[model samples]
Target: MTTPTRRAAQAGSGALLHSLFRTKPVDRIVAEGGQGEGGELKRSMSLLQLTLFSVGATLGTGIFVVLGEAVPRAGPAVVLAFVLAAVTALFSALSYAELAGTIPVSGSSYSYAYATLGELVAWVCGWCLLLEYAVSVSAVAVGWGSYLNEFFDKAFHFTMPAAISDSPGENGGIVNLPAVVVVMIAMVLLLRGTSESAIANTIMVFLKIGVLLFFCAVAFTAFKAGDVTPFAPMGWAGISAAGSKVFFSYIGFDAASTAGEEAKNPRRDLPLAIVLSLAIVTAVYVLVGLAAVGAMHWRRFALSGSEASLARVLDESTGRSWPSMILSLGAVVAIASVVLTVMYGQTRILFAMSRDGLVPPVFQKVSPRRSVPVANTMIVAAFISVLAAMIPLGRLVDATSIGTLFAFALVSVGVMVLRRTRPELPRGFRTPFYPITPLLGVGFCVYLMVGLGGVTWLVFLLWALAGLAAYFLYGRRHSRLAAAPEGGGPPDSGKGAPAAGEGEP
Candidate 1:
């Protein structure tokens, strides 16, 4: 159905915010309960499956593609940059863990903001997350397309048309067919349900980690000490720049955080999942970076789509195409898997927003049989698919990093706000270093944001502003919190008195 008029939405949202947050405990903004009857959206996912979701979502084609871009900037020190990004991610993960423990909601940072900051801020937070998840899936799909082409030519001895393979803006290519196809497939899987996708995602994660491990082993054989001659050839600036670029790889930690509502024992498992995933991914990124740089000159690892960067290294080391073919095949599968998991994350975030009336209600329509938001998944898939098909992989990656960094900055700030306002609220997992850890997270995220080019920042700002406008026009008014009955708020919203939806603390 069409959402409320823009002016009405803004007025409604403003009124709702004033009423919801002004109270002592903010008890006037709970969500409508029994959304899908009694037993919709079954919690069939285990801790291991959830961990795979986070890792699979985060570890996709980014390393395969962006590493080339980052290596030139940091030279040998890009490894250090990966560690810095991981450290920042860890802090954010800690804050996420605490919030998840206390709230255990599906809205992620958006819900957190509503409970602590107010309604308007919560709407904006949700808007920013939209950018992070949707744009990220598009970026990963494009990256996957790049590697797919490379693998096809090297292993199958065939090449697709440039127009079908390359992005429209860059060069003269028309569309990226492979990227678009993968997005469509992911949408279908999401419509069927999460259980199946979780299984597929777990398999994909195994393959990606395995491929990286294999590459590390093989690349090390050709590793030469001379490659480290000018370790800091580009100095700390370059190192920091590379680190900033690589930071995009760690955005998946929140994927784990997003599963708070479904997780069994979110308090303990959420924190563990976030920290462990970050640590493990960091080690993989750093090791892969070291192997790539050591196997060849840091200066010559072309930052663009070098289809055969890994293959060339393998050829140089083993003097054969078989090893290169193996890497190529593994990369193709890994990229596809990343697209699936990341797209799944995007659809879920959209579903949460829609259910709250922050977006179109069409997204909230769950399938009777599958218990999944079929239309929402299809819409997200279509948008990302068109983007992947038409846009250059490199440009899409740049946009993805900006959206994630902005959202991360917001979450870090949210943590501090909660600490001051809701000291009484039970927090199961507090961030260890308090202000220090969160401050560092903010600092690191901002640093990475700056490393992105002027064009990227400009585009991100324009899109975010557009999202805010949309919220004011539509989401703000129709929010269930605004429609909540008197006598405090609703339970799901953390505004009403404790009841069925009010939930157990």
Candidate 2:
């Protein structure tokens, strides 16, 4: 006995629910791989380039800067903390490797979620990635600027004035010029072509590894058995706290997955690159941590002037200023490499989302001559440069870690969901230990997210709410999936037709 008005309202609500929970089919997602608005992404990246891209994005300010903060919390047991954090990262890396192989798309977790968890969840994952990659790059650029100032003071005996070097409101500063400059440089390299950018990152990665080795050599020269006494001074609580702190060091190991469309053999090479890069970064961090504690007592890491702890250790070990200067030079290179690769990850994620019609089509518009998303790169670079240039980004930086952990947790769940939904699908890499590994990944991610405390949780909640608003206002109406026939795949699947304006300028 319902009236026409009531029946219409019920119908509208049903339609909204259907759109929210609709999942993209696996075959359809794969079929649309490189078919963006303009040119396709060139498949030019090899295993080595992909591996170094992750390494370059990951092995930055964490080891160079965060190590000092972590060592003070865990004492000589900081070495154990590094190992523990690596173990946590390993669990999630396994899930990422398996999914990256099975899907082989540029969206990373967002696409994986769309193929398993539904469109609403997929949009949330994509939003989290935006926060994780964009904010992390901006924060790292600010660190790079400080290190550049340190290098200049050490090597050239000249430092830029604080007003121009520091962010606004810090020491009477106006803008962080060096941070802006580094982001712009990374932007230009990205615009040229993906292959050229990969080559540049490879060189920078090797240079930073050599610099870390040089540090270990200098640190070991003054090693003493006395520094090993009283290990784990703060007990298990301290080691756990330090493990949570150092986990940020492992954030960018998934950078390789964002290059799925650009990789020559994504299914095989993506898994290898993700795992290999994590192993290399963990080994380097453990080696440096052991060497740092061996050369100087752990208590000194808590003292004043411990900002540049590794370089400080070098000065103490060699009783010379030259070694510290070399260390500062290495920090400059290490951070800039991170800026380049991470910014690259951010653009590719947007490109994938744009192709799904969840964002502006400009993000998917590639330059035919370069086979790269030129407008997307430029837009992302401009936004990040502004954030790095003007924002202080102090405690707000922790939001990046929370956002990343949330995405990682969703990926782990996606693995389990996909396994149940599509057991017959071929997988280039199977996560060994199956459900146990993915469950542990989810647990570890939650553990880290909780450690970030209440303030970070509040920030994440606000961000999620804003994302939902955007979805309702724009994403829902424009979604390509919604436009497709009911229970069918994407409308343009297998066609791979380029959108209008599809060639070189």
Candidate 3:
């Protein structure tokens, strides 16, 4: 016979285990659109606007600057590296498309995880996003500052003092004043509202595509077959190493899906924008890599100091001053847009987490007039500003890549879990081939993660540990779900609207 005390003990253990893995109700998240506490963000963004958001975020700072560093690591085989990174990106991207189309929520992978995997996993995913968005923006800002300094020296014959232009801990400088300046500028624009940010992103997307196309046209004119003859000189090890670093270039497309609430047609447009933007950016990255190496041998390419390598490649290829000058100028504009879009993503993820009472209520406070999370944006900006001023770009890029790969892998797994747990859930987009697609997504993400090197793994472990500590200290006890009535906890995305593919009328 079971004793009463033993029964109670077993019940207590079960409750503890349940609470540890408590899942947020998807219907509740979907219901918030029609009757949430704070006023909702405007749904003024069209499919085209959302697509531009994806491209604008992914195309800048990366293709413009990464080649100088990646080329030397992989020799001319960095082209294959870009292709490998693209395959990894494509798989995770498919998983993202399925979830974004299904949930149509602001939290991206974090929200997706909450609806399927449980709160603990959701918190971990959100924490990883903090690392991904913040570090990527800071790295882009540092790259922009270097390009800005170069533009000033060439166009104006003057450069900012190295003491302020370079990062504090590296390069013998006091602070990266220019990097901090760009972050502040983006902060101001976001506080204004989303509409202004969207418009700027659309314009910058066009400019970035046009400029990269221009570079390719000019570089091919100087293309020499001999330059690529010794391709893969460093072989597969080099290719894999550089692929890990270049993976950072593919991260920003998910930022488009983060705007699910403000999108005009979340179900139809979110997945399209995610896939389209990635395809566009991948094509551009490969062509530019081929053009650059064919014009200038990979062995001689180096990012020594702060020079903008693309602009240098253009100048050397064309043997003229104007082409390089144009490339540098375009790079400056392109990177600022990247900063704005990425910072917006960081804020929204915090806003979503805060709304669930995971972090703190302070992050949930939205501005009524602007329909934006003003306090959240400022908090993200302040922290990112400090990091940009202090850290080196190379280190920031590596850390960002590792964090993003982890979050992406989790999202891929979440897709498979949701399918098994809630097969009845309406999915606007289904990942083709089901389990295989998501499994490969997880596999590739893990492969690239290992390529990030041992140093990055140590830093990432420390970061993940801190997130777990914070969750237990505050998030667990105050979780909105546990506080709800006997059935479960609450808030949602589209007001209980049946998912587009979930047998909706």
Candidate 4:
């Protein structure tokens, strides 16, 4: 693990300060556009929008789909796993908030890496983010399809064929049709532009939260405290395993940090978003987990996919089909929102990278009409839809955890590195415990990574190797920072040459 040199790390920091503080390409674009068009990019997001985005992203598939899997692993102690995962997420999120405030860019971890680590490492981090958000969204889409099938079966007495409901590995007939459909829908919404998606997400967020509240209300009626008597029947190992398994629920909290560029006041709102989102979501997760397990035995959970586990919990506790049907419908809506939000994050990161010349110019092309990256959104949707339709959600979820842990580890390390090297950088929020907090984040993330299967590690390794190869073969030669003339570009051509204007390719 070669860490970035202090000097190379400062390169991006300089760029950030210059881009944000001075009159540069970004300024030129804003000036060229009327006032409102440029203003939206920099205007601060409200506390409500920030909170909703975070909770909405974090609440999706993890609770609806992961609870069954985790319950089996940790027995009745799954609630503890939720608490521990929240702590780990809290540490990393604090670090993320600090960096987001300082860097204030759209690239999230990728931008931070570029500013501190250099071109090569930034490229790798961006690649890891691709695995984390894009693939995970698709995985969630597959889970959404399973729940949709169940919802339809109960509500309208209709069902998709098992083949269309499940992946090939799970004895399914064909493809995950609903998963594909949902991804396409999200794609269409994204292409329509950011405002439309935000409005849709806000509605989805309400629906998801309402359903969870309903489940909690109904579930408590069936709750029996005796079911949790042997809380740690599986012991510390089980608690750890469950925590690792369910950590994905907390993965999207960083979505708040990603919007630092667009934030009204990133330094103030970003930290609040990160902390508040985690606090709220963790409380909901713990309460829901406790209520469900308290209502029935943990042994009742069968680990097939999202639908099977949820169906089991519903029938065992309620002894009726209607509640399960409602839960299934909620899963469909929640997971679809999650996929949309997560995919949107992925595209924005790519947009930041392309704007910096880390990737191809095509990814940076914001539509003159809508201010959305039309080509980039379509390209990402097309790639992920195939995964959603064909790949098993279980495999994708496990892989996504690995990618997320890797990025968290990097951020933790970056926090320590930046503090020592550039103490002068203005951080709106500082991580609580300094070396201890970041180190804890790293240790916890690594422990979770170990709990994942060997196959996940192997796949992650392959992906990283492929990313490194691509960076050297393509990105390094064409990077904007590399092409720019020290002071910031208004340079020459498209490929390997500097960019001149705001929207020019």
Q: How much lDDT does each candidate structure score? A: 0.71, 0.89, 0.82, 0.74
What's each prediction's TM-score? 0.87, 0.95, 0.92, 0.85
Model 2 CA lDDT for position 97: 93
Off by over 4 Å in 2: 3-12, 304-306, 490-505
lDDT: the better of candidates 2 and 3: 2
**Which ranges of candidate 4 are over 4 A from the true structure?**
1-44, 162-172, 302-306, 391-397, 486-505
Model 4 lowest lDDT segment of ten: 496-505
Whose TM-score is higher: candidate 1's or candidate 3's? Answer: 3
Best by TM-score: 2
Q: Report the C-alpha lDDT of model 1 over 1-505, residue by residue, as the tens digit.
A: 4456877889999866585452212332222321432234545566687777778777876677667778788887878889877876887787777776666556677767766766666766677677767676777677666677767877788878877877797657888888888888777776777788878888878887998889889999989989967888889888777776677777777777666545555555656666777777888898988898898877777733355566666777788887777787777777777778767666666666776677887876777788666777788888888777876556645675677777677777778887887666655578888899888878877877787788888878787789778877887667666665641343434334321322243
- Error (Å) of candidate 1 at residue 108 is 1.8
Regarding lDDT, does 1 or 2 come out ahead?
A: 2
The TM-score of candidate 2 is 0.95
In model 3, state the lDDT of residue 307. 45
Over all chains combined, what TM-score does candidate 4 have? 0.85
Q: What are the root-mean-square deviations of the candidates from the true structure over C-alphas? A: 5.5, 3.9, 3.0, 7.5
lDDT over C-alpha atoms for residue 80 of model 1: 87
In model 3, the runs with Cα more than 4 Å from the true position are 1-9, 33-37, 169-172, 230-238, 302-307, 391-397, 490-495, 498-505
TM-score of 3: 0.92
Residue 82 in candidate 2 has what lDDT?
92
Candidate 2: tens digits of C-alpha lDDT, residues 51-129: 9999999999889876678888999999999999999999899999988888888999899999889999999999988
Which ten contiguous residues of candidate 1 have the minimum total lDDT? 24-33
lDDT at residue 322 of model 1 (Cα atoms)? 77
